[model samples]
Every structure is written in structure tokens, then in C-alpha cells.
Target: MKCSAGRKVFKDFLKCEYSEENILFWLACEDLKRESNPEVVEEKARLIYEDFISILSPKEVSLDSRVREIINNKMVEPTSHTFDEAQLQIYTLMHRDSYPRFVNSQMYRKLAQLPVPNRKGSIA
Candidate 1:
């Protein structure tokens, strides 16, 4: 399946598993990394950390102690790459763990059978 199609499937799977925050955090990090303004980068990085890395956050992602420590240190002066390690970890976790299950899910099977759309938006 295409990466974008797989991403949509995986996101639905994450929602079913009540762990959509993982993908959300990864997407946020991607957006932060594309920022041209240093101030915006710092602000977005801190927000992402607070939302996904802080232990107190309800949406906190599971991360190893080493990565957690790295993030904590970087939070003092947050940068766009501050969450790179953590984001990679989450992405790997989802790809290795959730992705297989998603590919085999009944939902995916049903979606795969649907007719593709044409440029005019009609099913082909």
C-alpha cells in the first residue's frame, strides 16, 4: 500500500487502540522541523514536548529513559530537533508493532477492496 494510505489506516488503528497521540506527536515534530523562524521552532518544540514527553501529560508516549533524559536536557533550550530521537522511537514502535496489525485488520481489507477514484472524483 502507498505510504499515505498506510498512514491513514494506521491512524485509524491508533484511534481504535486509543493511542492516536503517538502519530499526532510525530506529525507535530515534522511540522516543527519545517519551521523557518527560530522562535516558532522553540515554541512548537516546547508544546510538543509538553504534550507528548512530559510525564504528567495524559498523552505522554512511551519512551526509554535515555531518550527521555535527552529530551529533558534539550527542553531547557528547545530546538526543532529536540524531539527527533523520541519521534523516531515512536515512529519505529508504530511501524514495527501497530502497522502489522493494521495491515491485517478487517478494516484495511475492506478499504483495499474499494474502487479507486478517477481525477474527476468518480470511482474507477
Candidate 2:
């Protein structure tokens, strides 16, 4: 909680893909690992955290109860694909804008589009 609380106000910057709450939860883990053990963090712990996060695919993220209900769920317009087409479609609305602004805007939901949850703690 040290790292999370330390950057709590700056938490707003860490969330671009989803609700700030849940994204903060995941990003906080990075801070946890780094601050917990800075020496080995870059080698062992970071890779482990990333691999674990990768297991949570976009489809899984889209299906998250919080994501569907809170983020303004609209009909997914059924697609034959196993992946979530709805989330991607909504995310693409600002695909052409500047990287930080468009990606970080509240208008966009990061949980769906970002390929990975990669908020490496700035503890260094």
C-alpha cells in the first residue's frame, strides 16, 4: 500500500484503459514488487507479474462484471469471433489521436484496447 498511497493522486495518470479503481489495483502490484525488492524486481518479479497479467486477455477483461456494468454496457452486436469485438470497436473511435491524450482520455476505456497492462512502477 505504500507505493499505491504514495502515488494515489497521480493514479489518474496510470489509468487509460479502464476504470481507475481496477487499473490502480493492477498497477499497484507493480509498485509493490519494485518497492518490495528493487534489486530483483526487473528480472524475476516483473516477468512473473507480466506473464500473470497476460493470462487475462481482452475478452476476459470485457467480460469482467465491473467492466460491463459500470463502463456503460451496450449490446455487443454479436460477432462470430470468440474475442470481444464490441470493446475493440469502441476503443477504435479515437485510434487516430495523439498517443498520450487519446490513450489516456476518460473518453476511452483502456481495459479493452491496450495489448497488456504494463504500468511499470516509477520507483526507480
Candidate 3:
């Protein structure tokens, strides 16, 4: 789940389920947190909201009304941490709803069968 390869596989599986937005939003939030410039933070936050939080977005992730309200309030003056709570909610939702399915998916099974690479980059 932490490794890039594993995340890609999971993302692919999610795409098949039409829920790749969960991982995409999570990744966006991660990128947002790494930002230092306030302007970048605001821009990224707005894009994230327009892309994933808005009801009109095709890729919108499901969120409760409370989280939505919080996000709306934060949008007045966005920051790197603006989406922290919403990110957590989406993370929990994916963990509880999508993760199990991903684990059981053929994509995961195939990944599980792949040989592990050693520090030298050769299959171990």
C-alpha cells in the first residue's frame, strides 16, 4: 500500500471499479501537505475541491455532510491541511470499503505472486 508499485496496482484495480478517485484524492492531499508556499496551497486546495469535493465532479468521492461543511468553511482561506479531515474520511472509507475488495482482486493476487526485488534490483 505504501510502495509506488503497490499503489499503482491498487489504483488500477480501483479504476476498474470506477473508484480510482479515492486514491487520486488521497495522492492530491499528500501533494498538498508537502507544499510550503501559501499560494500553491490555495491553488492546490481549490483544484482538489473542484476535482473531488464538488458534487458536480464526475470523480467526486463520497463524503458526509459534516466533512463537506468543514471543507466549505476552510475554502475561505485554504491551507495545506485544509483537507486533512476529509482525507481521513475518504481514507477510512477506502480502507473499509475498497481495500478488502482490492486485496481479493486478481490484480492483488498477481502482485502477490511476483518475485520480490532485492536491494540490487534483482528478483530475490
The candidate that wins on TM-score is: 3
Taking all chains together, each candidate's TM-score versus the true structure is 0.84, 0.20, 0.89
Q: Kindly list the per-residue Cα lDDT of model 1 for residues 1-119, writing each as its tens digit.
A: 24876777778888998889989888898899899798998889888988988899999999999999999899888888999999999999988987787766667757887554567
TM-score of 1: 0.84
Assess the local accuracy of residue 70 in candidate 1 as a C-alpha lDDT between 0 and 100: 96
List RMSD in Å for every model shown.
7.5, 17.2, 7.3
What local distance difference test score does each model get?
0.85, 0.35, 0.92
Candidate 3 clashing pairs, residues 3+ apart or interchain: none
lDDT of 3 by residue, 95-117 (tens): 99999988866577667885555
* Highest lDDT scorer: 3
Where's the lowest-lDDT run of ten residues in candidate 3?
109-118
Q: Judged by lDDT against the true structure, how good is candidate 3?
A: 0.92
Model 2 per-residue lDDT tens digits across residues 5-90 = 43453345434434343333344334443443444433433332233223453322223444444323321221122123323432
TM-score-wise, the better of 1 and 3 is 3
Going through the candidates in the order shown, the clash numbers are: 0, 4, 0
